[model samples]
Target: LVNGVLVAYGGMVPFIATLAMLASARGLALQITDGKTQIVTVPSVLDLGLPDAYVLGIPPLVLVFAAVTVAGWLLLNRTTFGRRTIAVGGNPEAARLAGIDVRRQRLFLYLLSGLCCGIAAFLLIVLAGSGQNTNGNLYELDAIAAAIIGGTLLSGGRGTIVGSVLGVLVFTTITNIFALNNLQSDVQQIAKGAIIVAAVLLQRRTVRDGT
Candidate 1:
């Protein structure tokens, strides 16, 4: 909510606000534990993360991810709010001119983002069995790379849940391959950056040709 207000009414850039929150949140976490990881011992939570725990041969976490993805797809592809979101993203001024409440849309979108983040945080805790401030380093880069690679326009205006999912799978595969090859983290970072750049260039070219 604070983040939404900051971006919607205070004219702050979304990325800047998110970055600040990420940094501050991590810092506060580190301070609380002096950089130690807190282990979670609850069996129920651990079951969600472990591979041994499965339902219908599918892991709980995977099911949660799939359900969320489907819900997102339905919301974006079949709902009025999704259209408004796209319009707001593509051009806030134009959306407002069209009688859409652009600021409110932005605020709601931010709230939606926060809700997703909370879900992700829970998943992370279950997966790791421990909470550490050091985790999720360079996650923003990974997220941006995945989205752009999945065909989500950097200029905003258009995005698809399926594309984002495939992008995540591709990125995860690349990460695993890097690990298998014993590549340095720096190398993986470089690869993600290159992917983003290439994706952006391709998007621009596609836009140009379309025009």
Candidate 2:
């Protein structure tokens, strides 16, 4: 609601609106928590995040993620709404001319984003057994990088849920590998930036080749 109102009604670009949101929300959260981490003592919530809680060796969080992925995939690939979303992303003016309500669609997308954030927060609470205002700091970069690497065109016309999932998996693998090798944080960031650039360049070439 906040996102939709700000971006759709307030006439602010999504990036600027969301960045403002981040700052305001972060400030509010810090004021509420005094910039401290709040520990979770609930055994049930904490247990869900444990290694032994896996079914068939698949973590519960992975299951939740898979369910959400399937739902998103269906919504995006198997529905008229999804087509409209893609059309709007590819060309908003064209979509509006074609009778799609562009502002409404954008607002709906913002709402969907909020829902995803809620789900992510729940997962983080389970996995960490604590909550902190700083929990997701800088994660947006990884998300964007993953989407781009997953074959999501930077220009925003096309994307796939499965591809983005794979992209995030690749990004996570890189991070884990770097961490295991005891690399510095700066080095990891450099590697990630390089990967993003390479992915963009390859995508551009593909687009140019008309393949």
Candidate 3:
């Protein structure tokens, strides 16, 4: 319920949800790997989309992506639920002392993240033209890195959907530009690593200078 809202209405919620789902699915696979008379394969919704070029295919996805991002921003910035999330993330003890339900908050946070993953998983399959078992590998790392590079604190109290979006854009643009110029994958990887380190250091310097 709460998780559903977060996934549908929060930006990072989907990524979190996807990780949870993958974890659960792996568990299920393990439990049922040898127990069934028949195998059951789950098909995702995005697998059914029509084939088309990137220009045509990208529009609907972009629209859905934009809608999710905007909803996330509104939920985080303009809702009481968002306030409680911030409190819980910022300081669990303080939030509990202020009458917030810490367990509930954490539970919902994870649930919302799972739901977000479902939505994102749908988009990913469509974008990639296939449902792959290893499709989203390391996405969480990229997202977390983008967030950190965009000025989100690792200590977990302050962040924004807008900033995360911009961060993702910056990362993607840099990669795209490098690829267009025929840069090698190893060089691109090195460049990305350097950029992330530089970004983190700058963020720290900014924080220190602000004091």
Candidate 4:
């Protein structure tokens, strides 16, 4: 987890710094060109300009994120491919008996997880208007915490995407409320940690009761 976070933050730092430099240059040029000057701004994505690629009426960020989420859901629930995933995650021995390749299922799951991470990183860049090394710091923890809170059994195989969504919303709501109250960042972090532990404990109890 630490390594993944470090790599993500490392990439983000340079990306955001470059974006800032590009924006600064654009602003400077616009200022110098004055109102009458027409500086045909050719979009260079490498420079962070809104390029023609963006003009192809690209799907909105929210839509893109939703699409990815739905794709993940369908991949886990609708396809024979998805059934194999559940089987492997639920019981490796049974999956093998059923002639499912456990290794292949796990590999696919990891690939899917990677794809989701990439989508999330892109969305973070778009939404922040700039990326920072600290951007998404500890986000993995947040995601896991949300999944657990949403009732994904730690033992695996019993979680729903809908439950994960609700968990994320619940976590967001708590943070939003704390921000509105002007709490310190440290306090919010502590609260989040406590909430995650409490949520997991409750979930464990529920699982134990076989509900």
lDDT of each: 0.88, 0.91, 0.72, 0.68
Which stretches in model 2 have alpha-carbon errors above 4 Å?
none
Candidate 3 lowest-lDDT run of ten: 34-43
Local accuracy of candidate 2 as per-residue lDDT tens digits, 1-211: 8888888778888888999988998899899889999999989889998888999999999999999999999999999999999999999999999999988898999999889988988998998889998988878889889999899998888899999999999899989999999999999888888888999999999999998
Each candidate's number of clashing pairs is 0, 0, 6, 0
Worst 10 residues of 4 by lDDT: 1-10
TM-score per prediction, in order, is: 0.94, 0.94, 0.71, 0.71
CA lDDT, candidate 1, residue 204: 97
Highest lDDT model number: 2
Please rank every candidate by lDDT, starting with the best. Answer: 2, 1, 3, 4
User: Residue 53 of model 4: what lDDT?
Assistant: 33
Which one is best on TM-score?
1
What's the lDDT for residue 4 in model 2? 88
Distance (Å) between predicted and true CA of 202, model 2?
A: 2.3
Cα-lDDT of candidate 1: 0.88
For the record, the alpha-carbon RMSD of candidate 1 to the native fold, in angstroms, is 1.4
